[model samples]
Target chain A: MSTVKQAGGRPRESRVDHALAEAVRALLSEHGYASLTVDAVAARAGVSKAAIYRRYATKEEMTFAVLVHDLREEPPADTGSLRGDLTALAARIGDQIGRSAADVMTGLLADVRADAALGARFAATYLAVERSVIATLLDRAVTRGELPERPDSPVVHALLLGPLFTWPIVLGEDPDRIPKLAPVVARIVADALIAGALPPAAQDGLSGGS
Target chain B: MSTVKQAGGRPRESRVDHALAEAVRALLSEHGYASLTVDAVAARAGVSKAAIYRRYATKEEMTFAVLVHDLREEPPADTGSLRGDLTALAARIGDQIGRSAADVMTGLLADVRADAALGARFAATYLAVERSVIATLLDRAVTRGELPERPDSPVVHALLLGPLFTWPIVLGEDPDRIPKLAPVVARIVADALIAGALPPAAQDGLSGGS
Candidate 1:
């Protein structure tokens, strides 16, 4: 939502920013990350290069902005049970990985390798934002006491996000496998939390009961 | 180890292949995947460009050869319990991902996006090789009765390898968190196996004694 303010105190045109983002996304999809260029984005968006420079410090920043714009807003509140909340969250995450989002992500990896500065920005902006969202959901589960606090939130977050991103790369399969992954990961994490709270002996054979 | 034989009766020069692989690895570590070229590799290896081409039809093949050469050999065979086998396997995997191996893997991703033919070859040679190795190890576990026969061997393979690759990209941390990851995953999978075999009521709680 941040916009540049001109010297005359007028807000920069939101329409231009929107167009630039669309152009960037289109280029990212069509030409891929390796071929996308700021100049091309400016030409396609019909915005002056100077306007883009005024809005984003660098091409990497522009790409980061596009990703941020495309990312789904945080999961909606009031799904009720932890299972429902997670199922909804997983579905959204899966969708992002399923379509153009995966291409964008793969392109980002290429961009990151090509430019170290871009990689750092991507880590800070795109990855950090996603991690924070997952962490927030995990925190909610702990507060609700549907799960115990023992597996460490970040570990659980990694467990969930790790498989989501990795499936396509390692398995060479569709990201829609979230329907399968969500339940398996959710069950494992739930079991770990519940097991961690129990005595060692009691934890040994614990199974399906939540 | 399969190599296309020369039809004219002269055996292929093993040295050329070795030199090309070494050159490819060096170039990957230095210039990364984007900058690597078959010509540069041939030059660096002091081998004729024709010699390199005769060995590898493309740069992708040379790169794949380098990766397979760099991958640690199939894990050592042992009669140890499932926990020991998994722990050792995790450590070995961690070592590979921890060292320059991970950089090579990421570089491969960039190359895959740059060339479709290369991507297909890379996936078949590298990804397929890694999956086969993991599958072999897991099969040993099944034979030992530590794992139940699941028709989903491929899914389990992905679940394991996915996290290994995902951690570096998603968390931007050491992929060797395997020490922590191994036991947790092993425990979960082991429980899933037990759950598959046991009666419904027995599945709910973790009792220490049999």
Candidate 2:
């Protein structure tokens, strides 16, 4: 636990983590999440199974670390306007939806449904982290008076992200088209948030609807 | 090919088709799509694989028939008001997102990505059918003056459906909660369609953004 002792070990530990992450990504792209095993990852990464086990208790956890944690940790955008920030964020997301992204997600989600513990872990780790990032962006917009107070964060998050996520995967559109869709996506979100445009019924029912 | 001969044979043929469809649903629920085989479906339905093959060319085609064609053929909602129609439609869709729904969709989509022919068939059959239904609803709204002319159908589709599709599967939320979310979902779509609210830049760019 000593600082000097930890300094030498920390670098090696993180290096192993990186290798394991890379291994997971490679396996996911190649054979998908269902076929990805810890032993295979260890063999691929040139690390021992113990190294992967020490970090993650299950394949789901490993997937969370690689797909959600490492890949989604970019610095939050600040282009002085919410529109610019959202457009940048959208483009970044669109770029990340590589050809194999759908395969990996489809595989991961199938497993998540079958395992309750993994589902909870995903909600806690992946969903929570992603939601927090969006929350931070929305908070900045509110502070700038560019968005109304108490915008329905969950609704906003879903609307902004759902289309981008669905376009390539479910609709089978080109992933490259996401950048072109970004401006429109951003506009839709901004309009919903800024204008009190909820239908009469939902306006009363939802906190963010108004 | 005679009318009397066809009448004598049609009932039995339809009966076999129903059995095959039922068997496919059972297998999909029990073992998922990846593990499901033509042989297993044949055995479960007590029909020959050749009989299945006679009607459908492949397992993907059979899956498309049962999951997409049969289950999705509800009469279009005609609740007078677009809000009423959307609310009813949302609730119906929300109800249908039971536990097996995601698993089935995940499996179908994975297969769709792997097989080019299957993917093309899906776009032609399932995706085309769903889009036309939404388009009809939107057209009704436009006719009613509840929405503007020439709304971007695909964007509107994504926005309205993205949340409903995503919340239960990705976020691991309760499927039942989608009904509660429907009114809000409907309002968001309706607002985006009616008000022409758009971010300044995208307003100038997109057709309906302004």
Best by TM-score: 2
lDDT per residue for candidate 2 within A1-210, as digits (tens), equals: 111112345777878877877888888878766688988999999999877776677776677566645323553568887767777766655565543476676666777766667778767766776677676777787789876654555656666777777777777766655666666777766666666543222344432322
Q: Model 1: how far is A192 from its true place, Å?
A: 3.6
The model with the greatest lDDT is 2
Question: What does the lDDT read for residue A195 in candidate 2?
Answer: 68
Cα error, residue A197 of model 1, in Å, equals: 11
| Model 2 chain B worst lDDT window (10 residues) | B1-10
Window of ten residues with lowest summed lDDT in model 2 chain A: A1-10
In candidate 1, the residue pairs with backbone N, CA or C atoms under 3 Å apart (3 or more residues apart, or in different chains) clash, namely A205-B206, A206-B206
DockQ of each: 0.24, 0.37
The lowest-lDDT stretch of 10 consecutive residues in candidate 1 chain B is B200-209
Query: Taking the tens digit of each residue's C-alpha lDDT, what string does model 2 give over B1-210?
Result: 111112345777877877877888898878877788999999999999988787666787677666655324443667776667666766655555543466566666667766667777767766676677776777787788776564655566566677777776666655655666777777766666666642222243322332
lDDT of 1 at B32: 77
